[model samples]
Each structure stands twice: as structure tokens, then as C-alpha cells.
Target: MSDDVTAWLLGDQLNPTLDVLADADRVLLIEAHGFADRRPYHAHKLTLVFSAMRHFRDDLRNRGHDVTYLKRDSFGDALGAFLADRPETTLRLMCPASHGAAERLEALVDEHGGHLDLVENECFLTTPADWREWTGEHEPGRTYRQEHWYRHARRETGILMDGDEPIGGEWNYDEYNQETPPEGWRPPETPRFEPDALTRETHEWVTDRFDTWGTDDLDGFAWPTTRADALDALEDFIERRLPAFGRYQDALVAGEPFLAHSLCSPAINLGLLHPMEAIEAVEAAYAERGVDPGAFDPAGDGTGVGGTGDTTATTLAAFGGDESSADTDTTLPPVPLNAAEGFIRQVLGWREFMRHVYRETMPELARANQLDQARDLPPAYWDGETGMTCLSEAVGHVREYGYAHHIERLMVLSNFALLYGADPAELNEWFHLGFVDAYHWVTTPNVVAMGSFGTDVLSSKPYASSGNYVNRMSDYCSDCPYTVSRTTGEGACPFNALYWDFLTENEEFLRGTGRMGLMYSHVDRKDDEEWEAIRERAATVRERAAAGDL
Candidate 1:
């Protein structure tokens, strides 16, 4: 409420943490000029941001502080105007998520001649420095995994810990979380906030200002745009979704877009929800009871529509890995160990680890193309025009809601990107524009390192897969025009040939990897004639995708 200093808040940095909002006299919120125009950003993402910023700004003014918001063509122009309007002001900012962003902000501050102070982002579980400290113990090499980094995070945070040891006697619940939803089992729906005037105005503004890729309508738009609503979403998740979340966390169901996933990423990444608050809320919700294992199945017991199908190991774990079962408990937890540990690993371990990995790799990650993939992102990705049910379902969801479940993201979107040989950087940019939660820090490591393996880091092998993997994990393949069993010729799944061509092209690079041995063995077994058929068909798939004939 004072008029002594100015707090400059980026659109994403909406959290009013005490550190970021320390004794500020006023707040300066600017909508970067032509930001959405740079890429075909989802209109829903823009509305969520603009409406949230307006709400935050209005909240500040309601508390008696002056607020200055400039929706300018350029940030430089906004800052110059602000400097001229208000002299003798020091600009305080929480550090931007990417280095490039920080540099741009810094240059403006330097040119304007006002003192600038930058503090670490409070949204993350840990800072880049903290991540670097954690990595210091392990010698830098090709073998470093997020699991080790995640364990270090758990120990440091003392979350889900019984003194020095983990409470469950195991650090991961990934294996237990992979249950497919039972047929006719209805999943719970995520809460959708009705758009008010601010959101409506922002939607119209976005629509008039730019023509973007995603649907611009506000129907079914229900993301949290205020702190109170964000808290409500968090409570809703813990109370309703968290229980089933751990078990069906990886399941991909048609028409069930959010199933058990928290849907809290938008709020947290935007700074309305803090990481620890969510972590603690979920921990508290856990009905950690001493129960009989026979009576209570901790990990849903693989009870899908078909009594018990063959539990084939898929590569979903590479992105979100798993832990071995513990020796201590014959008894099950009130909340399944998989549910509790899976959520804990994501909030405390994986999210923090991903952010740090992005910071450490940066500009190099932006260009990291270990696979040397140079093909254009297929028009099917943007238009949802393909006959493949999996692509249509996933891409259609992204277009309509600007969202997809993590499994769909990995098994469907990212897996296809890896197999199709799309450029990592361009795909990374597309992800940034497409998703509501995407930021430079979040997208680069996820898209390039984890999703595409552009960086010669994270996994030793790229997250490549065929239609068979998708068929096992989802119903999308079941409804597709192509067959999962067919790897070549007419009506064969594109992923089949693309998956083989990927290995054939990168056989030399993959031969050295220990984990690639299984896939490599399969590659070796194929006769020369089979390889020729695969390569030829793969070429046709790419050509059709490029020409929009598919």
C-alpha cells in the first residue's frame, strides 16, 4: 500500500509470495506485446493468464496498493513509459523461469537506470543452485538419472520419511499406479470455474488480436484464476481425485481427459499454488492406516474390465519412473503406497528435478538433437485431421482443452514426436505455445531431454514406441484404422514403421546404450527384406503426413 517501490510481476509469476511482494508500494503487470502471436498459443492459456493477472491486480488494489498494468506492444515500451511516469523507483522482480527471459528483463532495467533486485522463484520446490548442490555428489556423466536426483530431493525435504528411512520402505509407487480403469467405471470430473467478465474480455481480446491454432471459445473453461479458487482446486483434488489418482494415474481413457490427475499444474506454475502447500495437503489426506493386505489392495490389484490381462512392461516409467516393493509392510496403507509415493515423487521429487535439469542444460538443450531428427512436425499434430484414433483423440484434446493427461503426453504426444523424427526445438516451441502449464524451464527439459531426448542427457535412449505399446496402455489404438500387429504395408500403424525406421537410422548411436539392447535385439532379428519393407513404408508415412494426405 506504500508508494516507495515497484513490484514487477511477470504473467506466469502470479504468486504473491512474501519474498516476491516484499513491502512493495505498487505492482506493475504487463502483457507482453505480440507474445501469443509469436506462436499459435492456445486461446484458453491466454485467457487464464490475462484473467488471473487482472484478478491479482484487482486484489492488490482492493488492499489499497496502486496497480499499474500496461498491455503494450513491447515490454520495453511499457517499462520506458512507466519510468517516465514514475521517477526514483526501484524495480523488484522474482527471477524469470528461463535465462533468456531474465536477460531481457535485466537489459530493460539497466537501460532505464533504476536499481533492480531479483529473487529466486518461490513456485519451485528448489532453486537451480539447490539442484546443482544435489548433483555435486554424483560425478557428471551419461549415467545420471532423475531417480537419484529425486531420492536426494526426498531426503533433503524429509517428506514421507520415518527418520532417515522412507516410511513405505520404498521410494517409488510407479508400478502400483499403472492400473487401467475398469470398463464402465466412470472417472471423476475436474472442477471448472465459470468465466467472469475479466475472462470473457480477455478471450475476446485474444480472439480479435490474433488468430491462433487452438479453439478460442470459453465453453467448458474452468481453470482457477485467483488464489482462493486455486486453493479450492487443490482441496478438491486432495479430497476427491487424490485417492483414485495414484492407481489410475497413468491410464488413458477416451472422453475422460482429467481422470485422476490433479489439474493443479496451471495454478502452481502460475504461482497461485505453492508446491509445499500441495505436498502437505496430499500427505495429510493419506489415510495411513495399518490394514490387512488381503482385505485392502494398495495398488488397485490390476482390476480392469478384463479380469487380469498380461501386465506387459511399457516405457511410461522412463518419464515417470517406479520403485521396487518394500519388505516392511504385509499390511497396506490406508492410502495406497503407490498413490502417496507417486504424488510425493511428482510434487517434491520429479517437478523440482525437471526444473533443475532445465536450468543446468539451457541454450544447449534448446539445440540438443542427439537423434539428429530433421523432419517437419506433421500437419496432423496441429489440425487433428489424421484417421489414427490415438492421434485424433490426443491432439483433439489439446486443441479443445489445451490439455492432456501425463500418460497421453508421454505415450501418445511425446512418443509420436520421438518416433516421427520431429525437430526437438520446433516441437519444444509448439509445446510451449500449446499447453497451459508450459514455460521455457518446464518445456525444454521435458520436450528435449525427457520427451525427445534432444539433449545427450536424462535417458540413454529416446522415448520411442510403436502402436503396440499404445494399444496396451490405451483404448485409442483399439478404435484406430490401423492394426497394432501389422508393422508394414497397407493399414499398418504408422508408429510401427516409424519406430523401426528410428532404430534403423540411429542404430549406430543406439548400439552403445545398455538399455537399448532389448529393442536392438529385435532390430537384429529382422531380415534385410523386412528392414527394406519397414524403411519404404516409413518413408510413405512421412510423405503422407507432410503432404496432409494421411
Candidate 2:
């Protein structure tokens, strides 16, 4: 097995049957300190990745692959130092999938004057060029927008489809995705497959290594690190959660973290499961139930489950803001197209678009700064003790579980950080540090594109909003002491003042935006005196945030 003397393996390159593993006598997998040094990544993220890497090493060793798992505790670049002394062509190494890893390895080999073999990691469905073509139209002057490009990707990928046409005669079933769950109606209970001894042991090891690595309080943590566990998690989601996922995708509850969430991103990003197959599993499950994905009501179709009674599959597009009496007895107008469109954009448009953006711009895309907002990350991001209920809960959840649903991510966490003008790098680092599934490839784009960084480009405007927005979307405010209605008064929620302040502060940047028009209209309607009061209140909130009073 001399041909297998040296094969480069990455932590995420977990697929055992990959071509790189072929004929390798001694596989070199690095678990470097530098790799985990980008930011104070969440403890769960560090634990999940390191534990998984260790498990992969063990599995490879058991399978007869001579695995050299380097520990930074004793060895300093053991593989690189070993190769440096050997003849130029004696040792062989494979290229890594990520740009950062690839660059680091290339530098090592070049410095040591050793030979290496680079091969493409054939894991993703779309090539880097495909993402480039989608985003290429907009260059230095214009940036790529998510919706326009996402549709193109949909047509190209043929997911949820017919021949050259979208399934259900529509590219997106977004209209049904609006309408908040009825009050007192609870979402389906999430399936929890508590970790067994393997995960428990991994957690203990991670705990011992990085006892003080993240925010205070890390205990009873559990996330699937091995391939088998990850698959089980995906299957659980497909069976129990996928049916109502689209409907409650944006809903948020104070203590409930997994409301109709797929919870598969960690697995998908970690190479435990492929995106195509994971998404397909959900799609297939829905099909097996004969639930017409196109016609099924995202808002429970008036069924008396998921906390509401049965409703019919009436297209919100046709319904047009007319409140349907099919489900709840409450009489509210049909949900707005604006909200519906925004929700849909996150999934069919933005999510898909970010993938293309990552593929197209990587190494370069990660550095793009549209807003140019630069500041060190605020301390509150790391410390869960921040008095702001929404921020504290959201960050706390991420710290403890390495998880947060989309609503908590976008409307709650991102909104506050942007309003505070937190450094994108800091915000990016915080997300990377805390989330179990967060990686540079995913975290960077989400933070930059869908969240605050995109001014007028991918996002029509900053996703900035006040405490009132959170109050509307979730029950988090009910437990909070601060008043959502207050602007500048004592006990006024920080978000209330900051939201208006953000609009007023960034007026020139946001004035002409179509999305900003309504907000501007409200701002305009406010008398000059009222406007002053709001601005002053906002100033107080910012000052308090700066003073760490919030």
C-alpha cells in the first residue's frame, strides 16, 4: 500500500468512499488549532466539529486506513514537518474543499518543497462556475439580487418541478406561508433523539479541552456529530417536522427553539448528508403522504393539528388579503402580499441565491462589504446576561444549543446587531462561534446578504426593525419587562427606539427604496414634534446600549 502512504483528509471530508481515500496507506487528517481560531466560535460548534473529526479518525483507523490524527498538544505540523524532510516527490497529499484549508496546505507544501496532488471535492450539486454565472451579471456597479438569481437557479436545478416549468404552475408556494399561527395554537412537538454514550463521551472530551472556550454555562449539550446520528436526525425531521415547515418557517416562541425547523443544516454542512438528498427526503415524505406540496396549505390547511383547526387550500394570491373564515374564528384581513413575498424570498429565493453567491464569490465574496459598517463586536453578543429579553434569549439559545430558528436569527438577533452597528466581522464571528452548523461558507453569506450587511443589494433594505416587530411575530415580549410600545420612556424596549432611530439615522440611504416607502410614509405622517421625540428616544436607546445598560 505504498501508494496510500500519504493522503490528505479534511475533517468535513467524512464520506469514506470518496476518491481521495482510494489506495491511501496513511491518511493525514489535521485537527489544527488555527482552523478553530477564526473567532470565539460557539462552544457547541467547536465541540460538534472536533468530536466529529475525532470520530471520523477512529472510523478510518478501524477501516484499515492508516490515519494519523495530529494533536496540537504535542505535534507542531507533524504531517508538514514529516514531509519537509522527505524527498520532494516521496509524499503525496490531496487538496482540501475549502479555500482557506486549500491555501494553508498549499503554503505548507510550497515552503517544504514537497509534491501534492489537488483534486476537486465533488460534494456539491452545482459547480463554482454555475454560482458565478448566476451572480456574474452584476459586477463592480451592480450586485446580485437574491430573487432574480434564485429563480434562475430553480429553473436550472429543476427542484420541485415539471418540464422546464415550476410544479403547481408556480415557482413558489409562498402565499400560503404567511398568516401567523392562531393564538394558543402550538406547533407540532419536535422529535428529540437524546444522545447515547458515544455523543456523551465526545461532549465530555470537548468540555475538558475547552472548558473556558465560549460563554459561561455549557452543560448537558447534545448535537449529532457522527454520520449515523446525523442521518437519524434528518429522518426524524422528515417524518415529524417537514409537513408544516413552510408554514411556520418564520414563527418564533420564547422558549420553543425548534418550531417546524428542519434542523438538518448541521448535518448538511458537515458532509454527513447531501443537500439534494436531504431536501429530497422531505419532499418524498410529503409526496408519500399524498400531500399536494403545491396545493397544501402551509398554514395548516385548517386542520385541527399544529395548534389550529382545519382550513382549506385557498391560494393567498387569489385570496388577496381577504381573511378566510375556514380556520380560526378571528376576523383579520388576508395577510399582506408584502409579508408573504418576503417570507417566500427567504427560502426559494434568498437561501438558494446565497448558495450561488458562495460558489461564485468565495475567497472574494467573503470580503465584499456593501454597507461598510465597521466596529468591534459588542460584548453583549457573547454574554447572555444582556437585559434585552429577545437578544438574551436568542443568544442564550445559540450558546446552549448551538441552534436558533430563522425568526430569532433574522428579526431578533440580526436586527439588534445591525441597529447597534456591530462589526460584520464581529457578528460573523459570533454566529460562527455559537451555531453548531455555522461555517464560514454559510455564516458569511447569511450575515452579509440576508442579514444586515446588504443595504440595497440582495436585501431591499436592512432587516432592521423595532421591538414591536418581535412582539408581533412571537411571544418573547410577554415575558419581558420592557414595554414594546414605549419609544424613549423608562422601561421602553430598546428595540422600539432603535428601530425608528435606524430609519431616521439612515434616511438618505433608505429614502427612495420601495420597501422603505411604507416606513417613510409612517415617518412622514409623524408631526415634526413627534419625530423629534422618536429620534431623541432612539438616541437614549443607543446610548444605553453603548453604556451596556440594556
Report the number of the highest-lDDT candidate.
Answer: 1
How does each model score on TM-score?
A: 0.90, 0.82
Candidate 1 Cα misplacement greater than 4 A, ranges: 1-3, 137-143, 287-334
Candidate 2: misplaced stretches above 4 Å? 1-6, 22-26, 35-39, 73-76, 82-100, 133-138, 187-201, 211-220, 293-352, 359-378, 454-457
lDDT of 2 by residue, 150-191 (tens): 578667866555788755566566655544565555665655
138 Cα displacement, candidate 1 (Å): 11
lDDT string for model 1 (377-495, tens) is 98988998998888888888888888887778887888887888899888888888888888888888888888887865788777788887788777777777888889999899999
The Cα error of candidate 1 at residue 218, in Å, is 0.8
How much is 456 displaced in model 2, in angstroms?
Answer: 4.4
